[model samples]
Target: MGKTPAELSIPAASISTEIPDIPVSIPSQLLERRPDIAVAERQVAAANAQIGIAKAAYFPTVNLSATNGFQTGTLSNLFTTAARYWALGPAAFALPLFDAGARGAQMAASIDAFDASVAAYRQTVLTGFQEVEDQLAALRILEQETEIQNKAVALAQEALKLTSNQFQAGTIGYLEVMTAQVVALDNQKAAIALLGQRLDASVLLIKALGGGWQASEIPNRDKIGGKTKWSQFLPIPIR
Candidate 1:
């Protein structure tokens, strides 16, 4: 750690100095917190919608037509009641039966895709939970270790002070004083490193919690398709 310029530094930010406990409903609540999980879930939704779209092809296509116009022997009489005429009709067809096999294949592919997405969503959830657990455990252990290191630094400083006093009094050799000084310096440096580890663990824990994102913040799957406006469908708070 001493030889490394790569450091973790977060200004004006801190969490509890102790390890955090996992929520009671980690499995259920994790879905809303993790953006990765949300992405996988949305993919599943999109794939499901594709299945519906593929199935809709099996239904007959209905076409409706209407025409209304006025015709007269002369332009002056074009708007007359005798020239008024209107016609309307409905038409439908399901004649392309040969394409049924292709449609079926497409539907099956969509279903396979949905299944894959679902599997991915579940994997994301599991990974999210594991990361949270890992960071929490690391944070807890680091907190305890930091406290121990602080005590060690304090004790080493006291020892160094005593050694210096003995050296000044000619009761101990200079080598003893140097040893005590080195021990104190190393312990102090290790304490600083422990503090840094705790800070880094906090950052990882925050990421595992999805950076304060909520499931409710996710947009409705329907609004994400076709001509739907994103802002109208998904309201996200800035900042």
Candidate 2:
């Protein structure tokens, strides 16, 4: 049997349903590649190194010394007994007995610096998450808005055409036609502006994520625990 027109013709409504899904995961992927996070991590590591240096001050300084030499003097002692001298002993040991709390203060300062680095790391991580979330939400909302605006533009254009035809036929006044044209133009301009906004938003998101955007490419979201591990070493949140 041959197909009827109803079966052969594609439905206009189905066109919308056929639209491909947007690549919304780009931002997420960018976030995973963010270099700022790495920089922050390095800062934390540097802070830790400083703390180690400070802590080392609490240990006593140990030194070993050794001296060996052949003594040559006047003819009387030149080769008389083959003069030789050798000495080996612990050179010196100095422990900070009392520095008016200087050593302790230095150690405390190192600790404080480390704590600050930890807090900074946490802030960076939190800011990253927030940026990703905000961009994702904006993208989602804009997608819907764009779809609706597109439909509105189409309807406005159609209305303008109908109104123009009516005015030419003397069924409507010129004012009505002008109003319709203005409405259609406004709708079209709004849609264009919205498209530009979407593009800008995408760019901002890409920047925030740290480039090479791809949301689905992001590592397992579960891996990002709410608490940053660096914070564990700090006694207080760094200002």
Best by lDDT: 1
Clashes of 2: 6
- Model 1 lDDT per residue over 1-239, tens place: 46543475536443346534444444446345466876787798889989998988888777778999998889998999999999987665554567648998999999999999999988988898888889878977987898899899899999999999999999989999889989998998898788778778878877887763344544444533335555653557432
TM-score of 1: 0.73
Q: How well is each residue in 34-91 modelled by candidate 2, as lDDT tens digits?
A: 7787678778888999989898898999888999776786666755557778789858
The per-candidate count of clashes, in order, stands at 0, 6
RMSD of each: 8.5, 12.4
Listed in order, each prediction's TM-score against the native is 0.73, 0.67
**Model 2: what TM-score?**
0.67
